[model samples]
Target: GAGVSQTPSNKVTEKGKYVELRCDPISGHTALYWYRQSLGQGPEFLIYFQGTGAADDSGLPNDRFFAVRPEGSVSTLKIQRTERGDSAVYLCASSSRGWRTDTQYFGPGTRLTVL
Candidate 1:
């Protein structure tokens, strides 16, 4: 429809808690990506999904981070056992093609604060 939409613009949680961040990509865009941004650093790639399968997920720090695009349109990023170090802005993006296409649109990130 419009651009990517993220729910719960901000979140506050305690350590050991879990959080799920959602992303709704642009219509007809088949390439979706997730990124995490910490203070004083640019966004870091967390995963990339082409259609329903993940094309790349190497940027995910560990098993605690996971993503899924079961329907190829909306995706979700799941964080398990939240830590203070995990606090950051979770960004979602979508592109017409794939990596380095120069047309990726990013969403207003969900700011997660782990207390």
Candidate 2:
């Protein structure tokens, strides 16, 4: 693909429901990251995956949030017991090298609406 692609571009669910957001990074990208953007706020980094392992996950608010990059190319963000506060635009990004300082191409994002 020419850029990162996220599945289910939009989602609406009631509180307490579970949701999964998928991200497919550009081929050959070695670093993948996940972020969440709420209305009127900038995107907040949630997790960073280098290759097949998570490099940083401290940005996850709580146990209800998690992400995985099992094969290094595709990643998934999982949410359990979704809350109205959890509604946000989940963005995925990828970089070819130097994750800390390299340019990261962002996806369109998955809009999750928790009612």
Candidate 3:
């Protein structure tokens, strides 16, 4: 049973590029979440999924941000036309179910740097 994991840990790219950040949650857990953390601020919820469906994605900034959990265990966050403002730590987390009330386990995160 693995905890949550994210790749790269750090990503540096120019503006307008596209990047896909990955997340792997614990086995048997049906809930997954994605969030972005800017410097000096708390993590902001971007999306959360239960099973194969996106339970909530209202936190997504715009059309440029998207995510998928096709099989309900692994998730990938896709950012199109990466902007300077998009530079932040992309955190992935998971819990036992589709509720945030429960403690969520977080990944190391992928820090995106847009220049």
Give one digit per residue, the lDDT tens place, for model 2 in 27-113: 999999999999989999999999999989999999999899998899999999999999999999999973568999999999999
Q: Weakest 10 consecutive residues, lDDT, candidate 3?
A: 94-103
Rate residue 59 of model 3 by lDDT: 100
Off by over 4 Å in 1: none
Which model scores highest in TM-score? 2
What lDDT would each prediction earn against the true structure? 0.94, 0.94, 0.93
**lDDT of each residue in 15-52, candidate 3, tens digit only:** 99999999999888899999999999999999999998
**How many residue pairs clash in all the candidates, one count each?**
0, 0, 0
lDDT tens string, model 1, 5-112? 998799999999999999999998999999999988999999999999999999999999999999999999999999999999999999987758559899999999
> Can you tell me which runs of candidate 3 are displaced by over 4 Å?
none
Of candidate 2, the 10-residue stretch with the lowest lDDT total is 95-104
Estimate the overall C-alpha local distance difference test score of candidate 3.
0.93
Cα deviation at 27, candidate 3, in Å, is 1.0
Alpha-carbon deviation at 39 in model 1, angstroms: 1.4
